[model samples]
Target: MDRLIYLDNAATTRTAPEVVEAMLPYFSESYGNPSSVYSFAAKNKDAVTGTRETIAKILGADTSEIYFTAGGTESDNWALKAAAEAYASKGKHIITTKIEHHAILHTGAYLEKRGYEVTYLDVDENGVVSPAAVEAAIRPDTILISVMFANNEIGTIEPIREIGQIARAHGVLFHTDAVQAFGQIPIRVDDCCIDMLSASGHKLNGPKGIGFLYIRKGVKIRSFIHGGAQERKRRAGTENVPGIIGLGAAAQRAARSMEERTAKERELRDHLIGRVLAEIPYSRLNGHPTDRLPNNANFSFRFIEGESLLIMLDMKGICASSGSACTSGSLDPSHVLLAIGLPHEIAHGSLRLTLGEETTREDIDYVVDALKEIVARLRDMSPLYEDFVKKNRQ
Candidate 1:
């Protein structure tokens, strides 16, 4: 059997063997609830605290500021909801972008139902929201501004530092959904003036169902989960002991190898992009060419539906995605692509191939060759392509 090529890191990454090793102990020998008062549980409790410190160091945040949650979605929901409730008196208005993951977009909608106002800023053709646009959208009643550090679909990194500075100047809390950017890029909360940030373990080669939110010191946000004191009483409920251990180990590894890993991935990603665009006619690369994530390469193939392409890739043991994993089953075209000014037909034809630490140049070359064949085969069967060719020839 041929080696499987996994190019969907933006959806989730394979858990590192080292991370799995780190987590093994807690599932059996060290299986004690962190909240228990007995001596057996004390070790697990300390492990949770120690892991928090490890993640805190990665984000340049204090240990007290990190709050654990289920994953990125939960962290995002918590951040936006907490901010809206905390600052309701200051103003009920919130600022975000149209290209945000549904986590933020849906949360904003929920907030609006509860009497909060949300202003969604528009992005450029490359899916970049300007800090000036963010500032202009800010009203006197605006209490919080939330933007993702990087888009999950297009992979365009946002100007978070500039936006954070604007939020600071206006005395409004700034939060970024850094789930897609946290381990992939360097993020210093203090340097960026970020009040809050979100991250998930599965996005960075760690165990699933564990993530953390970084809340800057002195931020007056309310508790997300209301239960027995956990996460320093900021987030409640018993902690997932093994998952936290795995996340800490993964975070440590990612921070240590970020530069080398990303450089290699970027090279392979560029190679794939170049080959796909050159070999496949009528294909266009999406997102900012230079400002995109080191591992992501999204494209739109004219007249070919992304799902059909994905199905063909799967048969060849290749894994890719049309858009965000959370929105996989939706029939509608990607909101990110639409927000970036793509027509509905073009948006529906988008493909997202995100590289990872395990991805190799050989794997990329195989995927590109497979893609060329698949796109060509699909286009041959497409009526749109036939009509396009006939119209152009005439």
Candidate 2:
């Protein structure tokens, strides 16, 4: 079988071998309910605690403040819903950017349906929301402010620390969907002045089905899941032992290798972006050049559909994504791309190539060469390209 080049780390990542190894014992010999009191469970419980502590330490958060959830979506839901309910008496308004992940956007919409007022702030062409915009959006009735640390599609990193400061001055709770930024960037809850944050394991080379929400010590939040005494009574369900173990291992590795990994990915990402834009006709970059994720490279090619490009790339043994994997099946252009001021045509032509630790320079070069061929071929079949050329020549 031929090796396929993977460049969709933003959608999800391949689980690290070390992460899998750490999870193996929990799924096999060490299998036990962390909530159980028997000796078999006691060992599992210790493992869970250790993992929790390790994650907390890495985030500069308290162990009790970290509530494990199923993944990023659940964590986003919990944070938004809990904030609305916890502060309903004080206010019923929430503010968030238009470019946030669907997790936050959909949850905010749900809150709006439930009688809460939501303010969707607009983003710049680079897909960045200004901190001042968030500050100005606050009202006397504002209860919380939610924004993503980094965009999943365009890879624009928001000014989260500044936004957090604005939220703090307004005495409003702040939550950031850090699923795309947590392991890829340095994040200190206190330094950022964030009240709550959400993360997923799979985005950071850990196993899927496991994630966490960081709730500040004094913040009051309602539980989304109701069940036994688990997750400090904040979240309820049988603990995902193996997934959590994998997440812990992934987090540890990320912490230790972050600087080196980031440098390498950035180098490759920038090289790919440069080469693709230089080699492909009518191609433009989609996000902030310097303030974006080290692993992300988004581009728009004129006169070709993103899905068509993805299919052609796959045929060349290169794996990439047109946009968010969740919305890939839908015909609608990505909300993130639209929010960045792209026209429908350009938005539909966008492609996201996110690198990971396993990605190599050779793989990037292969993708660049393949994309050059595919885009040229696709453009030849496009009536829009022919029309434009005809008009320009005349």
Candidate 3:
């Protein structure tokens, strides 16, 4: 284990060196509270404000529309809960896809417990939610529609613009969990009709404690935390000034390097997929092939368990995931895989390898060679594969 090859960028990325450097001053030298009204604290306050404007500009949103939060979970929880509470008079129903991250799914379930009716729409085998199905699910009581901009597990980019259009036509607030999509892809809130969007800093080479929620003008959702007048009185707490600055720095870097970075990633991603499918037995690709994220490649191999594969990869100094890092503890087959029509067995064998900017062609070659050996070894030990081989011989 002289070296580590990390392929789980969707879980979280290593903070960029430049972002870390940008954050250093806020920790010691400029360690003044942004909430402090003194002239001495103005630098920290200005830094926070400037970071907000930076994030807002990336989303094509107004500077005032962005509200900083602890991370993606808080932003998502705030969006769904606050929207339900704020617009309760209009309706008590919501719409979302079955393939959403647990942040969105769990919040929907909590709302259901509190008397909100939720419609969990199914996706096609490629993990694509139909905008028509979303429209069909809308009822007179439908008040909100929350969908992820991309599937965290499979990396299938969703029809955000189309769904956003549908929500707008019906006067429903649309919120997208852009935790995986932000910084990795181009998203213009105004162009896509996104009323609310959630993103995490850690997902894009920034500090883990900071994230932002974009709320369209006039959409007055209730405040998430309730102690101080931070985040324009919308979210309460002392700002993580270092985290904010780090996130801004990361956002700028991601935007500046997106085209070049993604081009290299897409080339490597395809190479990895091609080698795995061609060299391995009983392997199938997951997610939409062309429509997926440039840096993601998920696969399902017959007759082997995902946990076993992950463990073996770990032994070889490689890191990967069976699904999302959030739900890695769960024993049940992924609801997302089930939503996309995978049986429990095949879904149980899922492997998700999301690439990062630091990944190299040599890295992918190493991973592919490792997968060939691991999958072959795992399948050899399986009774299912043994039976299949005997059947073919007969």
Task: For candidate 2, give the lDDT.
Answer: 0.91
Residue-level lDDT of model 3, residues 193-264, one tens digit each, is 999999999999999989999999999699889998888888888889999999999999898899999999
| C-alpha RMSD of candidate 2 | 0.9
Q: Give the clashing residue pairs of candidate 3, or none.
A: none
Query: RMSD per prediction, one decimal?
Result: 1.0, 0.9, 0.8
Ranked candidates, highest TM-score first:
3, 2, 1
Per-candidate Cα lDDT values, in order, are 0.92, 0.91, 0.93
Clashing pairs in 2: none
Give me the runs in candidate 3 sitting further than 4 Å from their true place.
none
The residue ranges of model 1 lying beyond 4 angstroms of the native Cα positions read none
